[model samples]
Target: MALRLAQILPPVVLLVLAIVGILLVVLPARETTKTPENMYGIVLDAGSSHTAMYIYKWPSDKQNGTGIVTQHSECKVKGRGISSYAGIRGEAAKSLEACMQEALSQIPKSRQAQTILCLGATAGMRLLDIVNSTESRRVMKEVETKLRSYPFKFKEAVILSGQAEGAYGWVTVNYLLENFVRYGFVGKWLNSGRETIGALDLGGASTQITFETAEKVEDESNLKELKLYGQTYKLYTQSFLCYGQDQFLRKLLAHLIKTQGVKSPIFHPCYPRQFNTTIKLGQDVFNSPCTKSYRPAKFDPYMNVTVVGTGDGGECLASVKKMFSFDNCTYSKCSFDGVFQPTVKGGFMAFSAFYINYNYLTRLTNISIRSSNQMANAMRLVCNMSMTEMVEKTNQMERYLKNVCAVSHFVKILLTEGYVFDEDAFPTISFQKKAGGASVGWALGYMLTMSNLVPAESLGLMKAMPSGTWTAILTLFILLLFFALGYMLLIYRARTKQDLV
Candidate 1:
């Protein structure tokens, strides 16, 4: 009877101990999922021309956090001013409300993402400072008030500081380029010997130059640390205000007059006077201009009008090159650069390929049949292509692609290495006014989960181990062995009793 009882008890005790061991290993994992109560995040990037929103759900997949997913949308307010201070007029408030509502409509009701954040640049911030009047302040408050009334959960709207805005763009650009599918991007770029990359952001309202040194890599996460080319990472970026379209053109015109001494001596209407016809061109030419119309164009003479392919293009290219001449890039001889041209009202923001090249754009705008045939001939040198037929087809495709996606110029720049050029040509000039602002709250919230800002959690099935827990496990194993022996003894006694019965 004792022998039989011991045999059954040993097996039961062994099974119970195994179950306890499994639970001890799994319990911590269950606790890890206990998320930080109902907190969701939303990011609003309000540019001079448009506003974009990004939503994040909480309890984000441990594999991939919820901060910046590709699942977001944007909306533009027609009547609202881009100025942080003045865009919201009496009618602007209603317009902003409508636009925000429209943006909200795009977000699905099923999603419970909350914690709203707003970031604005150039227009919005500039206006706030310029119109520092009580009315402007009142209007800003009203705009904020209206945004809070949305149907979904809401957090306070934070206006990003200018430096934060630039940093956001810098981080965003690095994130995207680093993730370029073909480049094996992050592994290569992040690990390469290169310490810094020049970030030239030419936006509509302001143009910023950021010289940043890759700081440190954090737990294979989306965010990386970068030391600013100037001072601090967040606010250390230097922004030359009002350096966009209008301002850029003025600067270029001034440079042209100073260098060439060819003022009012242009051969065609498109040469110097096309941008702003509002300028008076003396009495005789004004009364009876080269053509029927002679309306003065509003000009921003400070803009860099040096068109790509022109001598000015060479000069501007040289200038940018000189700035980074000390270092060499592995990809190409040219520095990574770009130009941002946003139409009034932020209706459209055209991002030209980095390294300002005008010929690429001009070719798309005024591509000729001869140039098309030439392209075909150039293609023939490498591959077998029917020049005449292929030229026609390619031209059609170019037109379709440009009109549909506006990507022709960018593509050409990438392939051609800098800007395409028939020969030397003058650079076109343009500029944009800036009103910029950024919010610390928005910065903190958006970058809150960036690896540099947060610690890495144990990702896989293996969890954080408790200190000296292994010793406890060993002790448990020994105790289980003794218990099994005692059970065996009891079972043997039971079996012996049974035999006696």
Candidate 2:
């Protein structure tokens, strides 16, 4: 009986080992450590308006997977963006002091050295570079110096490219939406188009549009290849410099300069009918790449402008439409200015200056826009309001306060004419500032890529298991081998004894 049992045990042990190994190879992964082990990361979004610091926390064991990192906290710096310090010098780095110190207080001291610190300047810096590369470098250097003072591991302080801005913003939105893992799972069973939403970022100096598509991108410059969460996507992305809200105003002002001089008060259509503000045609206006070589003879160091609003939505739309060119496209299709774009598909997420007005304009009452007409109507309502009325409604003039009407008109033209989204599709486009407690921007995407969260090659179950899980697996194998060998030896000894009998 003992001999029979021993012989049976050997085969059973071998079978158990094979099953476990196969299971390990095929099963989806879960947390390796039940006890949470946390890690920290930091990214600074230096925008045209201001700089924001994002602190993220994730279980150290699941660094490579989606939905693991969560926004721990955020600190908005107290002053203007880093680029604003270009002319004055040194203040840009000084501006980061309060925010970096706040980061020190938020993160535990032990993790400080391991935490990463990066500064990615966006359109403001990009435009700054075009205006004065020397000034741009000074600003970057000053900011870098300040970031280096912190205990966190300083990685990079550089101007981010337009392609990176668009692609990374798309990654940020999709990652928070958990589209990477969803794509990974669905890709196994379906042959279909990408389901990730597109991204549109508007800043002081530029605007970016990026999305995934099956259409061929004839302009190689406009297409970018990205691999995230174990799936590959070819994205269409473009940045229209001098097309951002601030820069667009600069262009309009430049055109206004041609028709009107500093001596005569200029009447503009975008402002309220009674709105009056003086604008200087200082070098700041014409020195821009947007105003390159288009200096009007009437230009002077100072200019006064009286903008008389024509709250007529048609006129506002028409005026905004002139900023775009519909005839220059060299591709199969164009979204103005010859830029290549797939027919706009999926819901879009816009951020920065011209962000979707979901949580914004709260003073205007709870107005949620689902169609272009709704947007147009809402903007007209606010734009037509006198400065006194508008101030009372919105509390204060945000940077774009005066040009509310033009902004709304620009949003319509940019989306409908520039991106080819119909009026009804505006409902699908959500304008938000944050996702999953983090700023809904490119900073998080920058950190994810720098951290190597996406592996170059696919692993069957979301990359390799943690070291603890690997150890448990190894121990199981050892025990199985020992049991198999011991059972075989016992069976051989029993057989010899029976033969002797």
Candidate 3:
């Protein structure tokens, strides 16, 4: 009885437990430490016309926590975003390799980076084109292989989606506003009687509108409520899509004729402003002398009749007046109705006349199109304006969307559905860009945040390990433990026999 039990006991308890403990560390926590400083993180913000690369370090002391990350030091390289549309293959690899080398120069040589994470945006995610049809099942494979060719032991990259970018922007904006906005810390928006606000972010290819109010997230439970201005929008509400200035314009021109019921105009050699005119059927019909440029052989019926023009440019503004001429027409004025009319609020005209009553889209569209050009131009317009002026412009834009566009209704819908997701209810801002300029502020902020959270060594372990290997490990341990016990038992039996003899 003792021998039989002994044969099974060691394998069942000690061996099994030992094997499990090893697996707990090996399977669940397969994290391996990589060299510090040598772990390089590359963020490729691939826009339509340009690509920007930002490099970061994985610090040894980083830890996970709440609150906004502040450090942003990183090396940046141009020529990677939308311009590298052919998926990161061939020439793409060469270009990125050069960028990697250049980035290496920015960091200290004493530190070596062991892992590389390359994140691609826009084109890589949305508009990848196949190069040489002979290769892989997916286009991204080409991109993945090329990026992985880097010298680092661990090389991984991801192309972000449109929704992802919008979501990230929403998170970033809220975090920044929470830290800098007035009355932000009091969580006044969470109070039953506090005012609320909205936020909008317009990127090169997409725009996001967020309607937010504060809610009380009890330390004890998972509940929240939002307060918007005097009313509540919800916890958070937002909408993001691919409707942007350049894309909108291109699509508009592509669909003009079928939607308008007019023959396509010839391409006018004159400036865009001079092309605006009142056409007289003139009893002569086909005899009208028109430019050859605007003429399309066929019409597109799917055209969204709403036109969105860049809101910031006096030139763009001039172009709107000259081409569409909505300021003087009676049919186009007095109300925000009509597909062709331009609304006069928010210091600009509404493009999608349908959204005159939709606060989220209207407000976001206005900010997006108005400030659509570039940061420099938008900043210049407000350079001479006092704080009052800036606030007035901002508030006026808000009121215009709220009152004229009837944004409250949509905001209410989002509230009911619980889609509004701002950290707080008000618009808060920090002078990150201004203290050292926006570019430097962005860089420093990235560096500080990356250093505090990521440890370079765990990159490989994170990438490996699928599942279902535990059964094999357990069986192997049981067999080994049984063998060792059998040998010991045999020796004891042999010794007993010898003593008896």
Cα lDDT of model 3 by residue, 156-248, tens digit: 344555434433443333333332222211111122232332334333333334323243322211112332122323323222332333332
Candidate 2 TM-score over all chains jointly: 0.79
For candidate 3, the TM-score is 0.40
Q: Cα miss at 163, model 2 (Å)?
A: 0.7
* TM-scores of all candidate predictions against the true structure: 0.43, 0.79, 0.40
lDDT of 2 by residue, 129-231 (tens): 9779999998898888888888988899989998888888888888776555532321131222348899888887788999898898888988899965456
Each prediction's RMSD to truth: 15.4, 9.6, 21.3
Between prediction 1 and prediction 3, the one with superior TM-score is 1
Better of 1 and 2 by TM-score: 2
lDDT of each: 0.36, 0.73, 0.34
Could you tell me how far off, in angstroms, the CA of residue 373 lies in candidate 2 after the best superposition? 2.5
TM-score of 1: 0.43
Deviation of model 1 at 499, angstroms = 53
- Model 2, position 269, has a per-residue lDDT of 70
